[model samples]
Target: MSAAQDPGTPPRPHAMLIAQITDPHIGLQPGPATGPLDPTGSLRRALAHVRALQPAVDVLLLTGDLADSGRPQDYAEIATLLADTLPTPADGGPRVLAVPGNHDRRAPARQALAAAMPVAPDAPGDCVCLHVEHGGLHLIGLDTVVPGAAHGALAAEQLAWLQRHLTACAGAPVLIFMHHPPLISGMAAMDACGLLQGRAELGRIVAAHGGVQAIAAGHLHRAIVGQLGGAPVVVAPSSSHQLTLDLRPDAPLALRFEPPMIGLYRWTAADGIACHFSYVEAFGPSHPI
Candidate 1:
């Protein structure tokens, strides 16, 4: 049973609201296009949505693919927008945390966005693996980017470090964030290029720990819910454009101009965790039911 189910102990008074934004693909200023959609404008609208949330979120998780070409100027654009417009969390914690997508080059990403992320001494060359503790919750980030490849993989060293961290947090719920979705999405095109290796070992670690709340990821460019290592795997929608949903085994890869969106993960001692997807552009005003 969970902490909330323990009859002899008081329910833990901890809860967290996290906003996840992914695959911004913030290309250069001229025109950033993923199909017919303009990535830059889409991201601007997405951040606008985050600011409009009621009571604000506790932390913002940028799940990679930050830049289309991994260009310095593209990262600069993101930095400028985050520095100027991203809302400060209600609890006064760190503003945002991020990882690198396949599209992001390590040197540039580290030089540009590393300061905004947590740090771990054991992280391998330019790999962004780290952890953060907030409101009695543990958040772990793993770098799954494989140099010169579209698919992702976690090195054994990084996995070992992650195991150490998970072991240390045995009694507390730990949320793991990475760029690639570990499970196979029914969308064949995306799954073909998903996490390329080390998934089973990672799964075993999570299964053994038993304290992991959920695994949140991006790169599929759509919302997908599945199981990996007996834990919930959530694939968030891109903040820029979405992958055309075609479940056929031979479905051609395509992009759609669907309204970009963000993912929200809410966790409490009693409920454990729940996730929802919301559009970046408002369709209408909310009505009290």
Candidate 2:
């Protein structure tokens, strides 16, 4: 019989819950022909859904593309929304953590969000890298934005810093969160703009350390699963809109009105980690069978 089936086995400990919301694209404005895309409304719904979850999440992880344009006003709007929607730390709200995407201005984002999620002081330049611990789990956020470009990369200095942190973890479970995914998604247009540099080095580092339980990222605007150095990589869907799912090599970039979603990660000592996607829309109440 399995451990779960055996009465002698103790029950697993409570898992740490993390809600991942990504690619809100807060300032995006579509042309007249496409009609209005309510990015802000979608984000509000996402936050409401997270706020209603029972037992509550331990952390709220934003995986980038927070703003459509790198504008200080957009970042400020995001901060205002967070303040209005979520409860304060004193009121039992989960801690917020974030990294920057290509659409973000590093300095503006840092200024707006620093009070909630502070970046590491040792972070080189304007990168928003972070390292924090909760309940023995190590959370690492990497800033993968390439200024004025859609593609992403990791600098050599950042890689060295990451290596030092992973080395210090000493076999503790680690979860790395970033904006761009290192693996290809078969969406040709999106893959063309995916992580362009240092992915191999990142894989090497994860493989060498053997402590990374998983890597969570957001860029593809769809829920995707892949592997890097034998560790699982999960790509979260956008909270505002989604990319067209065409995989043809010549397929052009396109957007669709697919249901917006958020990712939830459950991590326990007995069961490493598992990811689930929750739609942002409400479907009324459920009835018993």
Candidate 3:
């Protein structure tokens, strides 16, 4: 009999649940005139949605752009917001992890988020990199912030670090999270600021390791997917606003009021990994069909 029909067969292991909310761009004084009135409010709603999920999320990943201008006060405010909205790990809340974006100041971001989302002890002084193990899965967060530039890149040292980690986790599944996507998005302006350096080397590393299940990122303010070294790259939508879908060669950057969304990633040894984009807003109660 098939496993489904055989009552004696053990059930499959529970899947690991991960929720990603990115590009909130919080602390915009006079928030964007188009999207949600307050960026923090949007982030709060997204976090609440994650908290309310039936099977609580195992990890909450703040991909990047947590602050609009990467100010110290902004990060302070973000820390407060996180403390107020999410319960402590001791209280059964998911582990929080973050990486800096182009809009973030590495020093301030590291200082503020450290208390809540600590990085690996071996992480370099120049950037924030995280490594965590949960339910036999390896989660790695790579910092792609380039300080004064809008584009992103990984330093050689950081790349070497990543290679060492991937090698150590040779046969285990790994999920990578970062700020800027390595692949080019058709959006002209956005593509110009995409991961300009280390793209090829990163791809080679992932291909050689062959254990990376998926790579998740933010920075485009929209959901995008592409392939890098045979693994799917899932870019999460912004929690505050989305960029207009303009693929023209010279299309200017623009914002849209599309519903804010988050990325839900589920992984299991039996089914591999799957990503789903979920809207953060509450759309009335469901009625039986």
Candidate 4:
């Protein structure tokens, strides 16, 4: 069976399996196995996991935080790793898609993923919002990063662009991906720095759009589910260390060396979209249930 296949989800020959790898946070150098976690190493392990998936995934969605410091060299390193690790088909297919995180620099990220992000004459050269259509589904990448701020917010122009695109989809199944989730996750310190002010406007657009299937995001470093504007919103965990899972109102800011995780989104006309979470790092030998 493919690593992405969930035994519970009976195989559907026509289903699209998309691998979601978020928040790798690769640094200037390779990550170490122990001590403070290394983002690059974690990313390598995640990629390996994706490569091992049965029958191969239709596409890989990288949900942001590609670099730890948004540095030029860091992006260069990421570009190199992606070139080396991403699956390439003899038929020359679309293998990966990404958006920028609050930790990513616009110019550097744009340069790094130039091919995936072609220049639109009407759009800014540095615009990170991207639209892609595959197998009758629409995937939109929304830029939620606030300049020079840890928090995220969608500007008026972004919300407008989103509505225009969603409107054009004409009721096709749409899945939106962004760095910061539009809703609060109850992690006090993190929620305090969550997607700021613009969520309502974005929510309004989503609620009005009937085609949107789900909004997926990354940033909290933990898998979570919530709703924004009546649409299902999913927050994918990091491929590296996770944030401490504290739901208390007074929870302190902290990180934990938890086993990394990734999300697999299985899409079919019959099922719509079904998401399954799987750990990237192996723990022990598998035994038959």
* Cα displacement (Å) at residue 61, model 3: 0.3
lDDT, candidate 3, 1-289, per-residue tens: 0001112212237787889999988887664466445788888889889889868787789999999998899888888878888887668777788888888888888898885456676666667887777666778889998879999998898898888878877667889999999899999999899999999999999999898999999999898999899899999999988899999999989888788899999988778999999989889988999
Which structure is stronger by TM-score: 2 or 3? 2
How much does candidate 1 score in TM-score? 0.90
Residue pairs in collision within model 4:
2-54, 3-54
**Predicted structure 3: lDDT:** 0.84
> How much does each candidate deviate from the true structure in C-alpha RMSD?
5.0, 6.3, 6.3, 5.9
Question: Between 2 and 4, whose TM-score is larger?
Answer: 2
lDDT, candidate 1, 195-247, per-residue tens? 98889999999999988888999999988998778889999999977899999
Q: Least accurate stretch of 10 residues (summed lDDT) in model 2?
A: 1-10
Q: TM-scores of all models?
A: 0.90, 0.93, 0.92, 0.89
Q: Which candidate number has the best TM-score?
A: 2
Off by over 4 Å in 2: 1-13
Score candidate 3 by TM-score against the native. 0.92
lDDT of 2 by residue, 1-289 (tens): 0000112222235788889999998889877644558888888889988888877887789989999997899889889988888896557676788898989888888889885456776777878888877655778889899999999999898998888888877777888999999899999999899999989999999999887988999999999999998799999999988899999999988888899888898988778888888887877787899
What's the ranking of the predictions by TM-score, best on top?
2, 3, 1, 4
Model 3: residues >4 Å from true position, as ranges? Answer: 1-12, 31-36
The better candidate by lDDT, 2 or 4, is 2
How would you encode candidate 4's per-residue C-alpha lDDT over 30-99 as one tens digit per residue? 3353456778888888888887777578778888888888888777777787777765643332357788
